[model samples]
Every structure is written in C-alpha cells, then in structure tokens.
Target: MTNPTALELISRSNRLGADPKNTNYAGGNTSATGTETDPVTGEEIQLLWVKGSGGDLGTLTEPGLAVLRLDRMRALTNVYPGVDREDEMVAALDYTLHGKGGAAPSIDTPMHGLVDAAHVDHLHPDAGIAIATAADGEALTGTIFGDRVVWVPWRRPGFQLGLDIAAIKDANPQATGCILGGHGITAWGDTSAACEANSLWIIDTATAYIAEHSSPEPFGAELTGFGALAEADRRAKAAALAPTLRGLVSTDSAKVGHFTDVPEVLDFLSRSEHPRLAALGTSCPDHFLRTKVKPMLLDLPADASVEDSLARLQELHEAYRADYQAYYDRNAVDGSPAIRGADPLIVLIPGVGMFSYGANKQTARVAGEFYLNAINVMRGAEGLSSYAPIDEAEKFKIEYWALEEAKLQRMPKPKPLATRVALVTGAASGIGKAIATRLAAEGACVVIADLDLAKAQAAAAEIGSADVAIGVQANVTDEAAVQASVDAALLAFGGLDLVVNNAGLSLSKSLLETTVADWDLQHNVMAKGSFLVSRAAAKVLIDQKLGGDIIYISSKNSVFAGPNNIAYSATKADQAHQVRLLAAELGEYGVKVNGINPDGVVRGSGIFAGGWGAKRAAVYGVAEDDLGKYYAQRTLLKREVLPENVANAVFVLCTSDLSHTTGLHIPVDAGVAAAFLR
Candidate 1:
C-alpha cells in the first residue's frame, strides 16, 4: 500500500508528464519525502521516493520509483565526491537504499533529496528550457520571476549540480524554483500539491512571456521553395522517399520508421533558420540520447522530383555518416564506450516531412516527438535572445558515459523477427489473421491488408497496438489497391520485409460446371493478385537492400490433381509457379520467395465457411461438419491441420533457418502421400 504523500507524488507526476507543455516524454523526474516504518527496525524513518533512471514519468508506477533513506542520502554530503568524481556517486547511491530499492536511482536523485523541501520536481518543459537556453538566460530569469525563481549556471547533472541547487534554495527562502542555465527547471514545495502548482506556475508564466515577446517568424521567414506542398503532393513525395531513406538509415542495422508532417514540423522546416538551428542540436540530455547529436536535412526544394531528391539524399547520407564518425573520434576518451553506430536516427526533408528511425516503431515516434520539443525551445529562445545550448563536449560526455552504455547493454535481446515488417493479405479472418497474429507475436510489425477495412482494423487491434500492427484496405484483384497495400506497409512500418500473398477464394466446381467468369475471378484474385503484390513489395525490398521474404499460400491441389476443383486448382498452380519464378529473379537482391501448401484448411477457414465447405463436402459425400475428419482420414498422417498449423509454417520460413531455402514448397497438410511433390 502506498503512503498518502507518495500517492500525491504519483498523481502530481502523472499530471505534469501527461501534458507535453509541462515536459517531454520520459524527460523529467519527481519526488516526495515521507515517513514509513522500516521493515527490519519497525521504526518510522524518513524516505525519499524519486523517479528512477530510464523510466517515463507519464507511465511510472511503484516499481519505477527509487527508495532511499533521507538520512543516509543527505550524509553523502560529508564524503561527497566533487564534480570531477561525480560518476562514482551514482554507484554509491545503491548503498543508501532503505530496503530492496524499487529501481536504480537516476543521476538526478540528489537534486530531490538534498533540496530543503518535502516535494521536488525536475522537468524539461520547453517554455522553461527556452529561457534556460537563451544567451542571456540568467538575466531573463531575474526579469521574469525576480527572486522567486533563482538562476543556476550550466552544470552537467551530477552530485555537484544537486549541491548547487540545494545551496541556492537554502539562500533564497522565498524562491519556488530555479532555472538551470542551458538545461531545464527545478521546483520545490513543502507539500506535493504546492510543488505541482509551483511547477505549473513557472511553465505557464514562461509560456505567456514567450508568447508576448516572440517574433512573428521565430524560425525566420519561410523559405520560398521549401515550404510545405499540398497535402496530396506531400504524402506522395513522402511515400516515394520513405523506402530510400529507410535503406540509408538502416545501413548500421534495420530500423522501424515514423513519418510526420505536423504543422509545427512543417513550419520549422519551411523557415530559413532551420538549417542553422538544426545544426546546433538539441540542448536537453534526454532529447539527444534518442535523436542523436543532430538530424540529417534533405537540403532539397519541396517541389523537387523524388528522383532528384533521392539522388541528393544518398550524397547527404554519406556526409552525415562521416560527420558523425568525426564527432565520435574528436571526443572519445580512454574509457569511452565504443561508437554505438554512425546512422542518423532523425532525417528531415525540407518539404515532405520528417522521418525518424529506431530499432522499433514506438521509439522512432517518441524520438520525433522529442525533436519537436527541441524546436519549441529553439523558437522561444530565439524570441528572447540567441539560442545557446550546452557545449558539444558536454553532450559527448553524456552520450558516451559508461552509465548510458550500461543502460543500452541492459536492454533484452531482440526477438527473431524483431526489426522486420510483414504484410499479410486477406488478414481480416481465419488463416490470414492467424498468420498476422503469429508474425506480430514474433516481433514483426504486421500490416493487415484485406477488402474489409473495418474487419482488418479490428484484427489489427486484437493482434497488437498500432506500433506492432496496422490494418489497410486492399482488394488484390484491383491493381491500384494491391499497390496501395504495399505502399501502406512502407508508410506504417518504414518498409516491407515479408509479404504473404494469402488473398484467395475457392470455387469447388468441376470442369463441366465451371464458367469463364469463375475461371477469371479465381485466376485474377489468386494468380494475378500474387504477382501484383509481389511486384510492388519487391520494389521496396530491393530498394531496402535488406533481404526479405515473400511466401505464397499455395495448395496441395496445385500438385495432387484434386477433383471438381478446376478453377481453384488451376489458380493455385499459377501461384505455385509465380513463387518459383520470383525466387529465381529476386534471389540476386536477397529477397527469398517460398510457398506453403496446406490441404483443406477447413476449420476456421474463411474460404471453407464461405460456401466452399458445402460444395467440397457434397463432392466427398460427407456432412459439412464431418468434412474435416474425412479429409484427415485420407492423409498419410491422418492428423487434422488447423489455421495455426499453416501460420506456424509461415513463421518457420521467415526464420533464419530458412534464410538460404527458397523456391521450395512445404506442405502443412498433416502428410498427404498422393500430393507429394515430384
């Protein structure tokens, strides 16, 4: 059970973290001092509950709080290491734990415990940062809040910075908060509610000041040809450029992508000062950790052709990599961790939009959001005075800090298909849905492409959240819709890596009973549809230069010569050959094409439920309910094959064991002696 004060602290932290105006995601810390009975001593003791390292305040829980004894923590001042040896203090914090520490203490822990207050909040709100980053920030602080909010000089967050803030608070008895130069803000109160109000007051006041003083064009006048294009044009251009950009940024490793052209981003990109400000990089330590030192600007006009932009993008990417390498070499010390990577996490195009990449989708999205925070800070700072961020050397110290490296190393090993993206057609129900669900479970971002948009979206939601999967409308028979589905995969998850051409229907009609329409309908949806989807997805896979997978849900009828199934069998055969042909061609580019033959996936199968089951049961002279058992009896193994069985086969083909296996068909038919491949 949580104490009343701790509960108030949680509530206050959530309210502050929930609003972007208050703080960026995971960019702040909060704490409360309270009394709790010691489990061993059974005596009331003072404790400090502060937001821990690597935890987001918005979603923080009990486990995310670091528990320390106030007496032990405060005693650190006696043996306090100076700024030069502050890194050691972080390790020493573990010794101050009151019990099983809830979480590892963050570097900002001292600021909360040492300050003379019962409640403390450390936040990187854009409004406060704007004043903090201004060239004349100290002067601006005095002007804005007088003695109420004091100003602290720029110091990398450590034991010493906490000491500085604690000393400042002690001297200024009337102060509610202090603005850390070129960093952020810290507010305190004797009570949790008072602390929250004081924090909000500081942000709201700073915001109002910036609004009153800001120039009409904080980012400078709009660049003529670089302003945002029409909505349609911007999207089309973004789609065309996404794959190429994804490939470039993925050189170090594959990354999931997020694209946004929100007014704030477009407004900044369109301005003349964007290039200069972007070069200066983000000020807050939290911002740069995810976004890298700086972003890669496209350096092209909004109206430029995609081909022209793509050509220049390659050139710019090379330069960006070289610059990043140099930045790493310039500041690396004897004990600095090895260079993580030379890839740009965030890419900015003048007209189209911004593309941010990460090992996964949510991270990419959050990185972009953080950059937006930096833009807001830049805007406010320029309005007050020249924007001056922390020095580059300081950024290097934080970025390559051993503590930061340890955090990265602590991340769990990625799943087999962790960074891969897959698109499954006809995924609204049955086998297709099963395949999409299984792929998502294995960590592949999935696209549920189906004719029914609503059902597709519902399936996507059931399978996972937006980052794990998305649903898009696609009619395989229509060439445009097929292409759109492939494009949707790229837009949603960066680029397509696996495509399952599973959109199909069955017409269990004899040769004599089949009409031309039946033949064309089956052929168009299964045969031509596979070809169309394959071609569209292949373009992206090839451009990504990251070997991918394309699997066809072919049938045993393709080889077994099943009776009363001319249209269905012939279409399945067409799909089977397409897999072979594509594998031979796409193999040079590392895209593997394979096929899975599942015999009579009747139970839970959409096709079997949609009229085909009745027709097939009639031909087999069995009741519809008994058809599955009858089919299993005829197989060599006599085992019933379910939708998940087929889904499992698809998963295996995409795994590393089959990396070199392609143009081959694996039967998920529970064994069929007659349908053996010749």
Candidate 2:
C-alpha cells in the first residue's frame, strides 16, 4: 500500500487503538505520499508506512511505525531470486526509510508496496483467525452476514496475496472489506473509521454465527478416505488430485486444500460418509468467486492405483461438464454469448474439501463463492434433491441482453418531453388503444382520434381528463375529419409532438375474389387514412419547430408476404416506405418518423372478424387454435407479439432517447425475421 499523508497517518493511529481486531498486533502502517514511480508509468512516490516490528498496536507510538520510500521497495519485488536473508530484507527496508544509510523499516514493507488502495490495514484478530481456520468457516460466515462480506480463499500472505487483494478490490469496487480464507479478515474504506467499523461489524457477525452453530463435539458423523496416507504422500496426492478433481467437477481446483494433519480433518476422513463435513467453505460468495461451487471430494482406496483414481476423477469431470453444458444450452436464447469458457465446477478431495481457480484473483473468488453457496444449499437439501439453477438460454438473455449492452455505451443525460402532446388515430381499441394508453403514461397529453364517436368518448373517459386525454371522432380517411382531429389536439393541448397512425383495416381475400370496393376500402383506411392524418399533423409539427414523433403501425405481413391478404399487405408496405421518406424530409426540423411491424396482436377489434381470421389461418395451412403457438415457436424468443409489445416499440421511438434516430422501421415480432431466415 502507499503511505498515508499526515492526516491519514493520524486517522489510522487513532483507529488502531479503537479497533478490537488490531489488539496485541503491531502498530498499523501507511503508504508513501506523492505519485509512485514504476516501470509502467515511472512517477515519483512519497513513501510506504508499515507496522513496526515486535510492537503491540494496543499501546504504540510513532517510533513503533516504519516508513519506507515506495519506489525502492517496489524495485526489490521485481528482482529475480528476490532477497531472502532477513538481514538483507531489513537492510532493504532501512534503505527505503533513510536511503542506503537510513533506519530499518517494517518487514511487511514489501507486501504493503504491492497494495493498490491508498490505505491498507492488516490485522491478526484472534476471533477472525480462529474462525477462518475452521473447516466450515466460509459456510458459517454466509449464514451470518449474507451479501455484506467478501471471502478470499487461503493464500500465503505477501506480494502474491497483496496482488490478489488488489484484483478483488478492482472487481468489487463496493466491497467494505475482505476475509482471507484459512487466514484472517482485512477491511478497507475511504476513511479509517469506516474501515475500522466494517472490520468490527464483520467480526461480530461471524462470532454470533459461530456461537450459534459451533458444537462442543462434532455435530455429525465423520467420513473416512485418505487418513492412511503418509504426510509427504498425502501432500503429493492432494497436489496431483487438485487438477483431477477440478477436471471431474469442471471447475478450477488449484485453490483446494489437502491437509494431511489435524484431528477434525483426520477424523472426518476416517468415516465412510462425511456428513457435517459437506458444509465447509473458505468464505461466502466473494470467496466462491475464486473457488467455484463445490470442491472435489476425494476418497482414496486402500488398494486403488493412483492412475485409476485419476481416471475416475476424469470421468466425473466429463459427466459434470456435459451436464453443465446441457443446462446452459437449454436456457440460452439464440445469438447469446456462451456462459463460461469451461464449466465452473470444483472437486472435493474427500478429506481436503473444495478449491477454485480463475485467470485472476477476482475470478477465483467468484467461482469459490458460487461453489460454496451451492454446496451449503445442496447439503441442507440432502441427497434427495439438489439445486438446478436457471438454464443457459435464460442466463444468456440476462447476460448478453442488448439493453444491458447499450448501458455500456456513452449517453447524454435523459430529458423528459413533459410538455409534449400526442394524437393517436383509431384509439378506440386494439393497437391504437394500447398506443394511446402508453403515450398517456409517459406524461403526454393525448387526443384519442377514432371514427367511432361513442367508443372514442368512452376511451377518453377511461384514460381521464382532456388535459391528459380527449376522445374525438374523425374518419381517418376523410381529409376534413383528419384536420378537425388535429385542430382539436392543438386547441386542447396547445401544440403536438406525436402522431400515431394506428387506424387501419384488415381484410382477407384472394385477388380474384376481392371486389374493387373491398380493395378501395382497405386502401382508404390503411394507406390514404395514414396520409391524411400525417399531412394534418405535420403542418402543426413543422410550424412548432419543436420537432415531433410520427409512428406508423404496419403489419409483419408487409415484409413476410401473407397469401390472400394482398390489399392489406401492399398498403402496409406503402405505409412503411412513407415513414422512410417522411423521416428524410423531417430531419431538418428534428422530427422523427418510425414504424412498428407486429405479427400476432391478439384481442383486437374488427380485424379478426368477417371470417378474416379463418381465411388467414387457412392460408397458413393451420387451424386458428394453433396460430399463436405456430407464431411463438417460430420466433427466436418464443414470445407472442402482443399489441402491448408493439405499443412499447412506438413509445420508445416517440421518446427523446431516439431524438437522433429517424426513418427507422423496428419489427416487434420477437425474432420473426430471424425465424424466416432460418
């Protein structure tokens, strides 16, 4: 860690005596001031402060502290066959404090030099260390504090551990502190008091849980496996078993521990079935991030060959990998990113328990935590059941969502169009009704334009007052009627910012059997009606100079080419093209034009009547009962294209987020386009 400033030093010293975790420990240290000069950046650094040797923090003074220049100490760690002799290490520390002829610095100076945080506190709190070294410490910690604490798998302290902490801090920028698995707890904060408080809180929580869960004697019968092996042989077997166990579980096993000594460990390994032993962990989720879901359970055979054991482990790994992949594949959506390069599995050396691995410390911690929680849950559930988390497809959607990805892109602060007014045509029911509802919800005063006078008034009443909503009857195809609708909107709301061209008719008929009148009626409502409404709205929008939103409700058949629906399809296609040209012409005024093409909008009025539904279904060679299912299955998301979904698309385009977007046609078809391509 870097050295603290005068203010930081005072703050740390004050907290040192107050923090119970630091009792009897050497006085705390600080990092150097000024910028650190490194090979990467080569900048000047102040100094590094470390706890002085052989002094208790509970009663310490400034003389008990060791201050060393950060740059010189950092240079030492980079050297190969780094100085190992105690005298040499002390000499290096002295040079850091007073040049080549300076006083001696703390022995922990090298470790402090490696930390990234401005402040780092290392304590060997008795309670923390005692609990940490216990077999089921991680699980116990989780049952105590839940999401508030982070756990690091056991690693030898010094440069490597400091580097690991730096990585963990980077990944979890919000963590209050960290616990070293099989070691002790470390807390960090912007201020010394905050850090000290966090440390106390963690210890207290862990202590409470331990007091409640710990037993005078073993709570469950122990299981036996590897107690017979010699110490040297046990260590070698455990080291070799790490990879094999990891392979069996499809997780990283480098972090797993294989202890050859200790009564609890030995006794647990002696039993044929390890009961309470199943619940052990280094820490909670934070630790699991490094370790993975579960450790390898190793049960050594008295006469079994090491090769056979390794092979069995390999088979287990294969089985786990296959199952994990299957789970991921089952829940994943089309075009989603793969969940993991390899399965996040772990092996438990029966007596040794779990371990984890990652490309970095954070990854290992995350893997370890996940494995730990899963094991606790599994053990609690007993062998009759196990946790089957979300499948890969669902996970992929959440992990690789376009919306989530968009959040990564730079964006300006959002501004609300609070004073904007909107007019939605054919607002009495169906897609138009949905559009009207949505616009109102977005704080826009809306005029529900419909040809049905009574239904229009009723819809307006349902949506509330004229300030936020008004019902007006106007035949969308009639030029005068369209003008009246626009005049009403302007009169009531002052000016217009949006116009939803949702009034359209759907008629199903083969070209030969279709009457000219039927064709004209369809075109009049779907195409000509759109022109009248748009032409009327564009005048007010252009004059206001405030820009605006124009949304056209087109059908998927416009692109898919449905049979026996020639007139409706052609008119929809024309409506879409109209949007493109409108967008081009309106760009100068900052007005946006877009369209939503929906496939199956169930529960709409008139559109599904007149045998049109049956006729359309017949064209597709399926009964009406299966239409929704067919459409859903064909879609990549397997979701119905509801009117509400189309409305959502219209609402998005109408908002300021798309202020720069224009002349676009977004299909709210739930991956229909991709389905067609497939």
By lDDT, the best candidate is 1
Per-candidate count of clashing residue pairs (backbone under 3 Å): 0, 61
* Cα RMSDs, all models: 1.2, 27.0
Candidate 2 accuracy as TM-score: 0.39
141, model 2: CA deviation in Å? 79
The 10-residue segment with the lowest total lDDT in model 2: 252-261
- Tell me which residue pairs clash in candidate 1: none
- Residues 1-678, candidate 2, lDDT per residue (tens digit)? 323453455456556646644432232343323434444457565666555654445555555566666667666665524322222444455555632222245544554566555556655454555445455556645555665666776654344556577777778776766767644677665555665667677767655554555543332443334444665454445544443342233233222111223344444445544433343432322233244323444455533465777777667566656665665567666655545544443444444334444432233333543444333333322222222232334334434444333433434432254556788998988888888888777666788998898998898889876546889999987898887787666544445678999988777888898888888998899899998888878876665556678889987777886568788888998898899989888889777888888886655644655466667678788888666667788788898777788878887887767778887788888888632421
Range of the 10 consecutive residues with the lowest summed lDDT in candidate 1: 486-495
lDDT of each: 0.92, 0.59
Off by over 4 Å in 2: 1-417, 674-678
- In angstroms, give how far residue 413 of model 1 lies from its true place: 0.5
Give candidate 1 regions above 4 Å deviation.
Answer: none
Candidate 1 lDDT, tens digit per residue, 1-678?
787777787888888898989999888899999999998889999999999998887888888899999999999999986887889999999989877748899999999999999999999999999999999999999999989999999888888999999999999999999999878999999888899999999999999999998888888998999989998788878888888888999999889998888988998999999999999999888899999989999888899999999999999999999999999999999999999889999899887788888999889889999899989999999988888999999999989998899889999999989989999999999899999999999989999999999999999999989999999999998988987888778777778899999999998899999999999999999999999999999989888888899999999999988789999998899999999999999999999999999999888888999999999999989999999999899988898888899999999999998889999999999899888998
